[model samples]
Target: MKPHTIKYAFWGAAFGICFPLIATFFELWMSDVSLSIANVIHAHSTQPLLWIIDSAPFILGIVASFAGKKQDKLQELNTHQESIIREKTESLQKRNMILENEIELRKRISVELEAAKIEADSARQAEEKFLANMSHEIRTPLNGIVGFTRLMLDTEIDDQQQEYLQSVMRTSNHLVAIINDILELSKIKAGQIDFEMRPICSNEFFAGVMNTLILAGKDKGLSMNVSLHTSLPEAFIGDTTRLSQVLLNLINNAIKFTSKGSVTLSARMFDADFGTRLRLEVQDTGIGIPADKLESIFNDFQQAESSTTRLYGGTGLGLTISKKIIELLGGKIGVDSTLGEGSVFWVEIPCAACDRPESHAEVIRNQAEPKSLNAKILLAEDNEMNRLLAKSVFEKWTQDVEIDYAFNGKEAIEMLMEKDYDIILMDLQMPEMDGFTATRFIRTEMEAPKRDIPIIALTADVMSVERKKAFAVGMNRYITKPFKPEELISEICLCIERA
Candidate 1:
C-alpha cells in the first residue's frame, strides 16, 4: 500500500481506540456533576481516610481513563487488521472480473474467425469452379483458329473468293477478346492492374460504348440509349476503361435477349447516408428473367436453365465479371424484373472517380473509297473453296487486296505476325487456333491505334447472339456467308470508318 493509505488506516484505528475512552470519561464527568448538585457530605471527622473520600472518585476516573486507553489501542489494532483483509478481498475480485472479460472476448473472436474461414472456403470453391469452366470455354474456340488456318495453307481455292476469307479473320478477333478478358480479370484480381483513376466524362463514356456497339445493334434492329441523371456530379473518379466493359456487358445482354422494343441504359444517384452513391441501370425490353431465375442469372456458366443452350449460346461469364467489377469498385449489384414484361439490372457504386480524358476514337472510320484488291492478304480458312472464294471477294473489292493462306486459327496468327495486311476477313469455326484467340493476341500485343485494324466476321447466320459474341470478341463486323455485294460494301465502309 502507499504510505498515505496506510496512514489513513492508522488514523481509523486511532478513532476506534478513542471510542471506549470517550465513553468512560463521559460517565465520570456525569457522576461528579451529580455529587456536586446533591451537595452530599462525607463523615470527614470519623477518620483522616474519610477526609480524603473524594479520592475514591478521582481514583475511579484514573482507572477508567487508563482502561479506556488500553481498550481503544486493542480496538485500533483489530480495525487495522480488518481493513487489510478487506483490501486483499477487493483486489482479488477485480482481478477475477478482468480475467472473465478477457475469456469472453477470446470466445467471441474465435467464433468470428471460424465463420470467416467458412466463407473463404466457399469462395475458393466457387473460384475453382469458374476457372475450370472458363478454361474449357477458352480451349474450345482455340481449335477453330488452329484448324482453319492450317486448312488454308494446304488447300487451293479460286472461286467466289472473298466471302470465305472474311470468316477466318472475324472469328479470330472474337477469340482474342475472350483471352483478353481472362488476362484482365487476373490482373485486376491480383492487384497488378495499373488502374488510372480519374474523373471520367460520363457523357463521353456512354457515347463511346454506344458507338462501339452501333453496327451490331443495327444488325439486330435494336434501339439503344443512355440517360444520365441531372443530379449526378458531372464526373467522378473511376477507371472508365473497366466501367465501359461492364456497361457493354449489360447493354449487350439487353440487346441479345430483347428481340423487340429497345435496350435502354440509364444512371441516377442513389441517396445514401454516408458516402456518394450512383446507380447504373440497364433495362431491356427482351426476355426478362423469371422470378425464380433472377438470382441465378448472375451466376457464372448459367443461362436461365434451359435445354435450348445451342439456341442462344453463351459462355455466361459476362454478368459474373460485371458483378466482380462493381464489387471491386465497392458497390452492390441487383436486378428487378418481371417475366415477359422486361428486366432492369443495376450496379450502384460510390462516386469516387477521377476526371476522364478525351477518348481515343471519336467515331469509327469507314472505307472512304471502295476499290479493287492489290495488296497481299493472309487468308486463313478451313474449306479450300472458302479460302479461294474469300480471295476472289477481296480481289474483287479492291484490285490491290492480296491473299495468303492458313487453314486454321494457329496458322492465321502466324501469318498476321509475318506480314502486314490492309484487312483480315475471319471465319468462326475451324480446328486448332481459332479466330478469337488469334485476334485477341494481335490486338492486345499490338500497340494502341494499330490494334484498330479491321477484322470482319464471316458467319452463316447473323443472329443477335452471334452478333453480340462477335463484337464482344472485337470483330469489326459480322458479315453472314453468301452475303451480297451491297451488304459487304456497307460493312467494309464501317470497318474503314472504325479504322
Candidate 2:
C-alpha cells in the first residue's frame, strides 16, 4: 500500500523463501534423499513447520511499516520546533540593538547639557567682572566732580556761578544714581542682596524718606504729602533701607512725570497669621500709563511709551528694581491707572510687630552735625583727582586733622611700618598690590597694634563679592565712591572712636 511497506515486505518475502528452501535441502541430505526441485516441493508439502515459517514475511513487513511511520512523525515535530527557536532568537537580537542605541543617545544628550552649563557659568562670571571694572572707573571721576562742586558751593561765589555749579552737581548726581541702579540690578541677578530685619518706627521712617524727597517735589512746584493710618504699628521688623529705596523710586517717578499736581504716600496695616501686612501706596496726579502697558512697565528697561524715555531721560530700571526688591522681601507690587488722569502704585509686605521700639535719640544723633575728628589718617589711593578730593574734604571738615597719602597698597604698608597712624583708608583696586592682599598681610603677618589699627575700605567697586571679600580680609568698614562728604566724615569719626 505504501513505498516503505512494500520495500519491507519484499525483503521479508525473500528471506522467508530462502530459509525454507535451505532447510528442506538440509533435511533431504540428512535422510539420504536426492537433492532436487521435486524433492524440495514434496518436503515443503509434507512439513507443517515449513508452511508456518513461510507466513513470517507478512507479519515482519507490517511491523517494519509501523516503525517507519513513527520515525517520520518525530522528524516533522523537530523541524517545527527549530523554526520557532530561530524566529525568537532573531527578534531578541533586534530588540537588544534598539536598547543599545537609546542608551547611546541619552549619554550624548547628557554630555551636551553639561557642556552648555559650563559655558553659561563662564559667561556670567565674565559679565560680573566687566561690570565691576566699569563701576570703579565711572565712580572715580564722579567722586572728584561732586566733591569739588560741594567745596566750591561752600565758598563765596556769585549767584550766576553758584547756579551753574548747582546744575553741574545735579547732573553728576543723576549719573551716579543711574550707575547705582545698574549695579543694584546686577547684584539682584547674582543673588547677592541681603536684607536685615530690624525694628523700624513707621512714622519716623516715612518722615525721613519724605524729608529727602520733599525738596525735589517743591523744586518742581508740586505738592507732596504723607498720610499714615492710625492702625499702622509704631514699630515693626523690616529692611528700612530697601523699603526706602523702593519708595524713593516711586516718588521720584511721580515728580518727574507731573507738571502741576500733588503726590501722596499713604500707609495702613492689617492683621495676618504670620504677623502684620503693611500696604503702602503712592498716588500721583501725573501722566498715567495706558491700560495695555501697565503690566509691562515693571519689566527691566521697559517704559510705557518709547517717547517716555526721550522726554523723561531715565534708564527705565527703577520700577524693575523696585519689583525685585519687594518680591525678595515677601511682598507684591502692582499699579492701576487711567490713560490721562493719574495712577496709584501699591505694595504689600509681610512684617512682624516688634515689642522693642527703636531709640528716638539715635535718630536725633544721626541728624545732628558730624563730630570733628583730630587724628592722623593714612589714605591709599592711586588716582590723583581722588586724592585731591579727599584732601579737600578733610580740610573742610576740620583743621586739626592730619592726613597722609600713599599711591598704592605697598606704599601704605611701608608707611604703616614706619609711622604710627590712627586709621587707614584703603582702596580696593591698586597697582603692585590690592587692598585685600595688604589687609590680609596686616591682619596675619604684622604684629600687635599695627595689625589692630582700624582699616576702612574706600572703594568704587560695588559688586557684593568685592564687599564680602573686603570684610573677609579684616577691613573694619566699607564705603563706596561718589559718597557724600558728611557721610565719609561720620564714618571716620565712628571708626576712630571705636579704635
Report every candidate's CA lDDT: 0.66, 0.87
* Candidate whose lDDT is highest: 2
Clashes of each: 91, 0
TM-score of each: 0.46, 0.81
Report lDDT (Cα) of residue 410, candidate 1. 81
True-structure lDDT of candidate 1 = 0.66
* Residue-level lDDT tens digits of model 2 in 1-499: 5555556566756665676667777878876899888887888888898787666666665666676555555656777888888888888888889889988988998898899888887887887888889989998998899889999999999999999999999899889888888889988987889998899888889888887899989998989999999988888889989999999999899888888789999999898777679999999999999999999999999999999999998989999999999999999999999878889999999977776584664421121332347789999999999999999988877777788999888999999999999999999999998899999999998998999999999999988899999999999999998888888877777787787
Q: Give the runs in model 2 whose Cα sits over 4 Å from its true position.
A: 1-96, 229-235, 269-277, 350-371
